[model samples]
Target: MPALTDKQKRFVAEYLVDLNATQAAIRAGYSAKTAEQQASRLLRNVQVRAAVEQGQQKTAAKLEVTKERIVEELAKIGFSNMLDYMRAGHDGDPYLDFSELTRDQAAALSEVTVEDFKDGRGEDARDVRRVKFKLHDKKGALVDLAKMLGFMVEKHEVTGKDGGPIQTETRTWREVLRQEKKG
Candidate 1:
């Protein structure tokens, strides 16, 4: 067998990562059916093993350089630290007030029983109410009411000036009532 070039050695190492001879062979540029035989032959050669190891080391070094460059570029773009990136990417509902809770209130909140709390007045205490409505598409066919109204209204769990997640359960509409009156 001839000595493999640097590019050929790198391809072989990538294929060997999963230890599937057929896959390794195909990835190293052999036809799918020939991959198994080619990979087996390559693996058995001492020179090929040495070359593959060298290729893998070079690939790893290149990957490290690429990762460092990406981090450096991100820092230049105002993401000075990894924590800032993580906070911007994943943190949700930044305005929730956890500071006002008493010990019992916090315990109750932990149990998820806040949904049952009601005012002493005669009116319904639920923050959200579900209402169904019909909508028509451009072709005058009835579209899903929930989807249509969903676009118009936003949902919230804890209510303040700032919005939260949409309350899918408790919703109402005056427009649907008006349409009913006209029909």
Candidate 2:
């Protein structure tokens, strides 16, 4: 394969930043009007595609990212349970107790809030502590993990009304010309 041009090399580098082809083409100095087409054509070129793959591999290696690590991270969020972070006290009231929380379990927590306030007035005043926490999107994490593991495949069915075969119209230019002449 022929070597990639300077603009193509730049496009590969920019593409690695976010994997957006049109933006990469634009950043590589391609005209905005044609950036989408330029990106499409450049990505189809064998040499440019190889360069992009090489760039991606280099990035993954540099970041120390691996398939197992990604799956493990997703699982930590997917399989997390609120019970893992809470426990019942002697009063039988459940409270946020992170005393024995593991790093993996903590990874699921997205937010934590603690409020200290007086619950009553005058002689009946009592200090109250409130704790709230939100977890990461478990469903999203599970879905992503399932897709990565090939356990989930999104299927799309295109059909006409009532699930029948798609309806299409095919017309010849000659027929259109004759109709136009009659009109």
Candidate 3:
């Protein structure tokens, strides 16, 4: 196969930074007006695509990141249960209990707060301990996992007024120019 051009190499490097093709093309010195089209075309080129994949593989190796690892982390947050981090007290009130919290369970925690205060004044005073813990967004993590696994496909439908199909008009450039000259 043909080697990538210098500009294409630059594009592959820039694309790896954030994987935004249009921005990568622009940064690689492609014309801003045509960067989006250029990026699409470049990505379709066999040599460029190979280079980009090779670059990604190298980066993944360096960072020790893999698709399975990412999915596992997302699953940790998606499948985590609140009961894993708390338990029912003698009075039947739920209280935070991390005595048996596992590493996987801890991964799902977003925040934890502990407060100690007096519930009442003087002789009637009682010490109260409050523990609040927030879990990472379970729905968001599940949605991400579903998308990554090809189980969820997001669709956007564009329509005209009243939810009907969009209306479009097609005209040739020559006809448009002639109409403009007449007006």
Best by TM-score: 2
How much is the lDDT of residue 91 in candidate 1?
Answer: 52
In model 3, what lDDT does residue 145 have? 100
Q: Which candidate is the best by lDDT?
A: 3
lDDT of 1 by residue, 1-183 (tens): 678776457556766587566777777677776577667777787887777667667877867755445333332332122232122324562223334444422321212212334455567554543222221122211122223434335555585346665445443568756765787
- TM, every model: 0.29, 0.78, 0.69
lDDT for each residue of candidate 3 in 62-178, tens digit (9 for 90 to 100): 999999999999999999998898789899988788988889999999999999999989999999998888999999999999999999999988889899978888999899779
lDDT of 2 by residue, 64-87 (tens): 999999999999999999899988
Global lDDT of model 1: 0.50
**Candidate 3 TM-score to native:** 0.69
Return whichever of 1 and 2 wins on TM-score: 2
How accurate locally, in lDDT, is each candidate? 0.50, 0.93, 0.94
